[model samples]
Target: MDVTVNGQLTQVPFGLSVADLVRGRLPDPRSVAVAVNGAVVRAGDWERTQVGPGDAVEIVTARQGG
Candidate 1:
């Protein structure tokens, strides 16, 4: 299946959960925020939230700056 991730089109396996996606992309899932189809998904729900094809996903990472 194809979905947009952070503005880029990418292919992912079917029934892929947000948690799986995050773990595959980032070293620390704790430092990132995720949204799908313009709605924010809570951290606790990541495991149950599945991303469907043609969905828009945005994974934003936190950065410390002064």
Candidate 2:
């Protein structure tokens, strides 16, 4: 299946969970926020959040600045 991540097109395996994606990209998946199809997904729910083809995923990480 194919999904868009941060506006880029990418192919992912079927039945891929949000947690799997995060773990693949970030060393600390807990430090970021995730949204799928414009709805925010809670951290605790990432493991259960399945992403399918044509879905849009936006992942943002926290940054400390002064």
Please name the candidate that would achieve the greatest TM-score relative to the true structure. Answer: 1
lDDT of 2 by residue, 20-64 (tens): 999988998767999999999999999999999999999999999
Best by lDDT: 1
Q: What is the C-alpha lDDT of each candidate?
A: 0.97, 0.93
lDDT of 2: 0.93
Put down candidate 1 lDDT per residue, 1-66, tens digits, no spaces.
Answer: 999999999999999999999999998888799999999999999999999999999999999998
Off by over 4 Å in 2: none
Off by over 4 Å in 1: none
